[model samples]
Target: GYNSHSVLSILMQTYMDSSTVLAPVPSFWGLVNSAWNLCAIGKRQSPIDIETTHMIFDPHLTPLRLNTGGRKMYGTMYNTGKHVSLRPDKTHLVNISGGPLGYSYRLEEVRLHFGSEDALGSEHLLNGQGFPGEVRCKT
Candidate 1:
């Protein structure tokens, strides 16, 4: 009915206006990307590197923070761009923190993407390189 289309239009507008609702930002994506790398390297590739492993505690739905190990390694600077991308998160690593750990990255959220034949359609390109997948990492 007309109500269904109207509701869909509102939802679509809201999603377009609110970026976070669609995808998690740098911290979440970055850590996920790193973890994916490890999973792909190892023999398992089983569960596709669980996203909850990197989940960070948040009281107000805050974005998860990541521990960069006090360094700019992993090129964390580009994480934000990936968040806006329409691709599966393939993070490869998630550094744990403790009482005396350096910086940290918290898990934010997990986003799924699909297209014709599940083809990923994303806006951000890495080094002008398009990928079927991407992970947004941040500190």
Candidate 2:
């Protein structure tokens, strides 16, 4: 659930500081192209009928933690960076619900960062939706 731009904004305190990080995960057009490609991959015909996904943003008012696996993740890591090294976060619980769309989670800590490379890149897809090479992490 680290994709909260609002929280990122708060953690950053300003957009000026935000740019120092990286580009937005998944360029909008990239996912569109990927979706179309994936949809046609196993299809019997040329163009295929694919279901589309929409971007949804909501206010993140709750704070949570990570799980046991997440804790072990933090236990073994490298602390070499210009900033404070963030580790695998434990999951904490939230009373609020994801309202059928999302699942309520807890805040244990923060799992460093994982992807093919950096924040601008990741290893998963949103139901096969890939706007760009970059992505967000939420589990």
TM-score per candidate, chains pooled: 0.22, 0.22
Q: Could you tell me the TM-score of candidate 1?
A: 0.22
What TM-score does structure 2 among the candidates reach?
A: 0.22
Q: lDDT of each structure?
A: 0.31, 0.29
For lDDT, the strongest prediction is 1
Q: Candidate 2 on 38-106: residue-level lDDT in tens?
A: 333443531122233453343764443323433234322453442223334333222222332133333
lDDT of each residue in 29-107, candidate 1, tens digit only:
3355663354335654322322343644545443334454465433122234334422213353433233322233343
List the candidate 1 regions with Cα displacement exceeding 4 Å.
Answer: 1-102, 117-120, 137-139
Give the least accurate 10-residue stretch of model 2, judged by summed lDDT.
Answer: 7-16
Which runs in model 2 stand beyond 4 Å of their true positions? 1-96, 101-104, 112-120, 126-139
